[model samples]
Target: MKFVNVRNAVALALAAAFMFGATGCAGETERIESVQIPGVWTGAGGGRVEFGDDGRFELSGIPSDAVVFSFIDPPPKGEKVSGQGTWSVKRKGSIVGLIYDSTGSFAEGGEAGTLGVADGGDSPKLYFSTSSDREYGYEIHKSG
Candidate 1:
């Protein structure tokens, strides 16, 4: 009887350990916002964009909706164009790429290289650069 009881106790302890190990302390979807993007960034052609974790987005000093984008900038306040698409990230060393679909009133959608993100208070702002290097940088503000 003693041997059987010890065996059962050991089995229970092992099972509990396995369960805890399988379920980590934090969920995978829980995004740990790191100091990656936050400050102001320039975009294509003298365009200015700001990002805040406080749930606000401004384009050319006008509040705007969170429209999906591929390469083009979000419609500048009162533009008929509305961008809808998906965005993915590819990383290599200190560089990142943002690829997306330019659906809805866009010319063509494809892969684009990510320049860098400026880490700021609460939210990190995403930035994009042009191949010509002459056009102003583009900023990606966070959406609520």
Candidate 2:
């Protein structure tokens, strides 16, 4: 009778653990799905980035005061740059990185940046930082 009781207790514990584990996994999946980038995001200084489900992206409304340091003799300051390119997302641990490829006149290169999500009521804000060292980057809000 003692052996049977112990076996039943162990089985019940295992079943409870499995149920909780499955629930936790489902919640994680919902979080990841919520973070999917497939909408128009507007940022400060009139900056905007639209990410399509088809992997195409459009960036525009960059402030002229923004600066971009290059290998040229004199680093050119950022202008009201706009471009169309392809984008891809990579997940490194818990961080989501966005890889952008520009094919516009402003520049013809790629940049990798980290994405951030804000917890502001119903509309969650999305932010993009070009450089990790910079104090201020782009703060974007989803338009739709």
Candidate 3:
């Protein structure tokens, strides 16, 4: 019968292209308005955060276990500790807490000084915490 109807029409077109590629990789998340977060942000190891609408903020290469530096235990790696600070944005519906300026807490998150924002369907994400009861974190994006 015509080769089993052409192999069932190629397995129903490969099962409708794998269900539309898994619904475009499960993408659906939107709501990040703190003025949509300032700008410049990139970190995977290189680090970079420059958010300033007026609240002021700046950090480079952050990775000293997410900054807990004090009297020094060899703690100095946010590219020699960020030198500009002052920021605030605490929301709970879509979660956007980034309250810096205290030498630490740029993603400690939820209910402790704060630092966490997400919606990276293609941009926007900043949450860095190597662990300090905040569980663990590291997700920085949004640059260009």
Candidate 4:
């Protein structure tokens, strides 16, 4: 009777661990899938970004004050500064490459350090960290 009880307890422990591990992995995958980019995103301060399925993007209402420290000569600021370019996702959707149009910041090209879904919202909020230090970024909401 004692041996049978010990074996049952061990089996239960293993089963619990397996279940927990499987659930954890599934949750991570779901989180990644939630960050879909092919849509219009509007930010808090009137900023907007549109990502199309053809790898093209357009932006308006981006703040002029947002500066990238990595650039030797950052783009100039103006009341109406819009950007258009192509974008690509890599590293299993963790990294984003932004190739801006000729008239905007990083006209050559730039990479967003991280991409993820914002917390505590029923609607999906996409967050992109523009700087490696994460000092500058955008939090935009998906449009219906």
Candidate 5:
């Protein structure tokens, strides 16, 4: 009986650790010069900003000035909330992994995803996934 109880406790602890570690924004990698859009950039059809390290971002279309998970602790409703945290680059097949803060919260936290940097003729265009698997994304160009 004692062994059973100890085993259960260990299992529970492992589960909790797994969940906690699972919640993160992105990973860390070598820095690469990406697009920097100073102005506001919305998502596709206005769902939410996918991924970018520039300006305030939100999922509800509400504008903000805070960068890297807006200063608002709880975050506002409708506005999914997003901000630019530190990120690095890693090569995975044809896609590049943009690893930001793993512990970040809000739109930029509790998740690990990717954003494709497509060539926009003059500059590289940015597209990020909205869902965990990265089904849809938004197009953003470098702000001159």
Candidate 6:
């Protein structure tokens, strides 16, 4: 029947919308000095980084210069990666980013890293660069 077909179409539309919105990435967020940016951020694939309130950080399962997520590229194989070090937030013009100086698994050719932060929503947003050109990155939501 015509009514049945229309109802099915409406249902499909709602389902699609729900799936799209379920990603949980905030559309607009800005993390500044005044905003709290210290928390545990879990990667979509596998890994967690803790930004401490005392300008320190501890990482688990995070590889050096990790380009995480199967959607981007295949993750590195072998032993699980871990690291610990200091971190700070720096502002350059309108952009505010988190800079890390770490050791452990992140020591080998991966001493320094930067992550763009955007907070102030229900969750925070962190843009992780996966390439050298800075053309591609992953936008991950804050887990806590």
How many clashing residue pairs appear in each of the predictions shown? 16, 0, 1, 0, 5, 1
Model 4 lDDT-worst window of ten: 111-120
How does each model score on TM-score? 0.32, 0.52, 0.24, 0.55, 0.37, 0.53
lDDT of 1 by residue, 33-127 (tens): 32333334344333444433442323342222222333346556645432223322223222223223344444455413233333334664554
Could you tell me how far off, in angstroms, the CA of residue 15 lies in candidate 1 after the best superposition?
49
- In TM-score terms, candidate 1 sits at 0.32
Candidate 6, residues 28-62, lDDT tens digits: the string is 43545524567777875577777778877776765
Cα lDDT, all candidates: 0.36, 0.48, 0.50, 0.53, 0.37, 0.49
TM-score, candidate number 3: 0.24
lDDT of 4 by residue, 1-144 (tens): 676445434533443343334333434422333246788988877888898988888888876554222332554665534777776664354334455545565443432223344432457665554443442256677889
RMSD (CA, Å), candidate 2 to true, equals 17.3
**What's the best-to-worst order under TM-score?**
4, 6, 2, 5, 1, 3
Cα RMSD, each candidate:
18.8, 17.3, 18.1, 16.9, 11.9, 16.6
Clashes of 2: 0
Name the candidate that leads on TM-score: 4
Tens-place lDDT per residue, model 2, 6-111, is 5434533443343334333433321223336678988777888888888777878855343222211212355565666565443322223343344543343443
Task: Kindly give the stretch of ten consecutive residues in candidate 2 with the minimal lDDT sum.
Answer: 66-75
Those runs of model 4 whose alpha carbons end farther than 4 Å from true positions after fitting are 1-35, 67-72, 76-80, 105-122, 130-136
